[model samples]
Target chain A: MTGRGDGIRPRPDAAAAYGAMLAEQLRQGGLAEPRVRVVVADLLDHVRTTGEDPVQAFGQPADYARAWVRPLSRWRVLGRAVATAVGAVGMFAAVTAFFRGGSWSARMSVTIGDLVVLAVFALGAGVLPWTLELWLGHRAARRVGRRPRVPDVVIRAGVMLLVLGLLFTVFTAFDPEVWEPVVLGPPRPVVFVVGMVVAAVLSMVRQPRSPALPRLPGTPERWWERTPGRPGRRRR
Target chain B: MIVAVVVAREDRESQWLKGVLDLAVLAALVREGSAYGYGLLRSLAEAGLTGLKGGTLYPLLGRLEDDGLVRSEWVTGSSGPPRRYFFVTAAGRAELEAGRAGWGAFAARMSTALEG
Candidate 1:
């Protein structure tokens, strides 16, 4: 089984990719790397003996990683809760400031209608991208037959857009007269466009490169059966 | 249609395997005294429990270790890379015994029910 050309020679690249992925997961899960290395070595031995493609045999690297980091989900949930709370507070302050003509110490005398409009804009600006990302991630996981680990750059961009849009909205609400000069000012649009384009390019560059596998034809039942929350099986 | 049926059956089997897998791994370690991941998996397969994926097994081992039911150590092979050998702890052995007893009783009850 160990002989070269005996159809069982280990694929070094695949083993390396698997090792890197496992290591990242272990790190994320706060496991000791030395301990994980022992397991990785053993798994590599299995790969050598069977000559099976690791991804095909074990499922997507991200999904495999996630299985080990199930405990991290609680922290993720807690973090999201904290973020939403902080965002709400910030949105309230921003909206209030906007209503007071961008004056921080202005009187809290805005009408209920004004408050409602600000709340709507704030929610739309802050929550829409996040909801969209989650929905897209769920859809991709089901359709692609693998877990969708959204890239960090994409996440950062979404956050940046959320913040920028919120700022723009608050500025407009503060005083429509002053808003145009600050946000849609002569050089601001050009800067925003350039920043967005650069961010998109960087995100594309940072995405993991993998050999594209052919997509299989999906049956209606299978499509419906694939719930976003369900862990996927290793597709051969 | 045939493919769909086979896929569904595999899905069901995988879910069933997940439930019994911890028992199987613990039993394998207890029987073997100590074994590395791949070697242990091969032993299980030889005993007729094949198709266990690495993704499934490694995390389970990690969890078992975390739960203090198993312990692992790195030992260098004479000719190749170091391997993590896992051994069943005393707690693990006790757990395995309890699990076996429970499973035996459950199986007997199910057998009687089905026979009826």
Candidate 2:
């Protein structure tokens, strides 16, 4: 058989390759092992019985995995949107306080330059966490052979520290007097801590009690079926 | 031109199949009483759901289990590796009935619109 084949060779273990790809995709999607095993076993059985190339039969591993993880992905997107909104509000409040020369009063005014600075702070605060997450997730996914779910606490903490540092550097350079009072003010620090605690409590209370699945819009109430995995099906 | 038309039709059919896959899987379980993952896939194929694949069906099955519509258990036999056999719950049967009725109604409406 080898001699007859000459340059031609038998295909590599398509079944194992398919299983590996599917497992990796499922892992990246943050699906537990038992769930991954169930799907992988089914695919292996299909390959053994029909001798069909899984890639040809099932299209791409990534596409299939995306379908499976649609709900989780949606939840993650929703979480990120909420986080971004909160970050914007927090940045605005902090910058405004600093501009008011550390007075936590309602009468403080924001000039155009102050607004510009606020915008810069917002961009840094918002974009740094997201960028860091993407980079970290990519690295984790590659390292673990599947995407690892970085906890919300870790990402949020990193972003908060980085943004605070950025604000300190910028404010100290531009307006030392304003920056000094803001950084050293007892009321501002107390308020920040209290606000964070309240926000955390509210988040815990508002977190959905149901399974972490996000319902696809327009799907029937009890459908429970995943959205089809076309290229543009993602809401993001 | 002919190829394009064929491809378009296939895409449409595939989309329709995906929408109805849950109903089909439930119906299959109801008919067969119980089946393993591969068994269910084969049955669906034999029943003319050619587009059904393990990737799609298994996830749907998992969701069904999550919803308490189906129950599964790992059984070990003398010959091969243990397989998890799935059985439709009573709730699943009720859901299947409702889904069938809804699908029938939708199909009728579509047919009427297309014909008229």
Best candidate per DockQ, number? 1
After superposing candidate 2, which stretches have Cα over 4 Å from the reference?
A: A1-13, A70-236
Query: In model 1, what is the error at residue A22, expressed in angstroms?
Result: 4.1
Q: In angstroms, how far off is B113's CA in candidate 2?
A: 2.5
**Candidate 1 Cα errors over 4 Å, as ranges:** A1-7, A25-45, A48-50, A70-236, B1-6
Clashing pairs in 1: none
What lDDT does the true structure give each of the candidates?
A: 0.57, 0.59
- Top candidate by TM-score: 1
Find the 10 residues in a row with the least total lDDT in model 1 chain A: A205-214
For B1-116, candidate 1 gives per-residue lDDT tens digits of 99999999999988877777899999999888898776677778877998777767877887788788999876665776555679999999999999999899998998999994
Q: How many collisions per candidate? A: 0, 1
Residue A179 of model 2, lDDT score: 32
Instruction: Assign candidate 1 its CAPRI class.
Output: acceptable
TM values, all candidates: 0.52, 0.49
Clash pairs for candidate 2 = A28-A147
